[model samples]
Target: MSAFSDSEIAGLKVARQSPLIILQPEFVVRAFTLNERLLVCNPNGRLDAEGALQHAYFSDFTDV
Candidate 1:
């Protein structure tokens, strides 16, 4: 959740992981209470989804 900005999120990947393959942060996969069964994505103003689309990784399919 630290890197909440969707535009910046595309570049903010995890530096380390077990397998060490391109690991991105799971801002959307957050801890939820047992009562919460459905997954809801409600980014009020923190996430800039439009700008994220222009990111190099996502904009260019070959880059990934």
Candidate 2:
């Protein structure tokens, strides 16, 4: 018997859609999840902006 239902598999596929990059007036960021791990990035070409992306990605309260 299959461990996961078809609906659950479909949900997983939907959740794993291609990542997107978000550009804001103050920062640029891209984020996605694979398996159970969350991956995030920034393309602002600044150390602080990159750091902020990392911080937000790792923070426990981050919604995304």
Candidate 3:
């Protein structure tokens, strides 16, 4: 699992999915595991608005 930000917010698999970009650089890898988001690092993490729009995955099955 690749993540834009390696912060605790997006450190684990869960965070990478909906990766929360506490910083700015982590707004690309991915997000959206429990919640809906978009990015590259979908380690079930939060995501940045700009990056979230990159992946845009709705669910576990509906990965966009």
Best candidate according to lDDT: 3
Q: Which digits, one per residue and each the tens of the lDDT, describe model 2 over residues 1-64? A: 3657866776664344442343232222322322113322543433454455455444554653
Best candidate (score: TM-score): 1
Backbone clash pairs for candidate 2 read none
Q: Go through the candidates in order and give the clash count of each.
A: 0, 0, 27
**Model 1 ranges with Cα > 4 A deviation:** 1-45, 62-64
TM-score on alpha carbons, each prediction: 0.22, 0.17, 0.20
- Write down the lDDT of every candidate, Cα atoms only: 0.40, 0.41, 0.45
List the candidate 3 regions with Cα displacement exceeding 4 Å: 1-45, 56-64
- 53 Cα displacement, candidate 2 (Å): 12
Q: What lDDT would candidate 3 get against the real structure?
A: 0.45
Per-residue lDDT over 1-64 for candidate 1, one digit per residue giving the tens place of the 0 to 100 score: 5546766878777865443232433322221221132233554533354544443435335443
1-63 per-residue lDDT for model 3 (tens digits): 335555655655644453355563333333324244433376556566655445434233344
Q: Which 10-residue window of candidate 3 scores lowest in summed lDDT?
A: 25-34
> After best superposition, candidate 3 residue 1: deviation in angstroms?
55
